[model samples]
Target: MNSPYSQKIVQPDISLTICGYSKVLEIVSNKWTGLVIYAMEDGIIRYGDMRRRIEGISKKMLTQTLRQLERDGLVNRKITPAVPPIVEYSLSGLGESLLVPMKALNQWTKENYSQVELARENYDRINSGE
Candidate 1:
């Protein structure tokens, strides 16, 4: 039986000119990266504060996501010289630019989450032969 939810897959055009965008998407598409960016939207935040604010993220995952964002030039990392190293993170100009679109996306998700969850439940029930 053909499921109504099933559709033909469309392959994306991955030419050299457009492929670079994939790298940007790869950076932001992770589970924790967007949350980290949103957490920093208020202002510069220390590592501990960010970790506490973003629940369910492990120390290792947060560290890795921050490092990746820094490397991609979306985030700035500042290290203070002190007995206990004080490391802080904030969005760079490029990162700030992302906030507008990210905020729109966040708003859309908040508005549509129930619809999305219902769709998911429907899909699951249909697939499960229930």
Candidate 2:
């Protein structure tokens, strides 16, 4: 009954343990989080700029996601004293490290998305006939 895909999701030792895996997934599982992280990758990003860059994100959701990322130490929030009290965001050291893997995953997704969609279509067609 053993299958490669059924293997343990998290290793007991090294890299991502069960708890670590859960946390990582919890953060990256949300589409908004990944988009937010990607938005901050180049350099410090302003809240308004982020909204413009990430199309379809609501103001509330972006705010919520940023707060979560700041709480997780994955992003740094900077507030500058100004007329409106300018707010900006940037990736923390921890967040910067995550990009190495995230970028690789992005590349993989870009390369295989078509294949994945085809698989899904085939699977749906076969199952629907049953």
Best by TM-score: 2
Superposition error at 77 for model 1 (Å) = 0.9
Model 2 agreement with the true structure over 1-130: per-residue lDDT tens digits: 8896687767444444457867678878888999999999999999999999999999999999999999999999999999999999999999999998899999999999999999999999999977
Candidate 1, 1-130: lDDT as tens digits: 9995467658644664478767567777898989999999988999999999999999999999999889889899999999899999999999999898889889999999999999999999899975
What does candidate 1 score on TM? 0.81
Report model 2's TM-score to 2 decimal places. 0.84
Q: Where is model 2 poorest over a 10-residue stretch in terms of lDDT? A: 9-18
List TM-score per model, in order: 0.81, 0.84
Off by over 4 Å in 2: 1-19
Provide the lDDT at 15 for model 2: 43
At residue 30, give the lDDT of candidate 1.
98
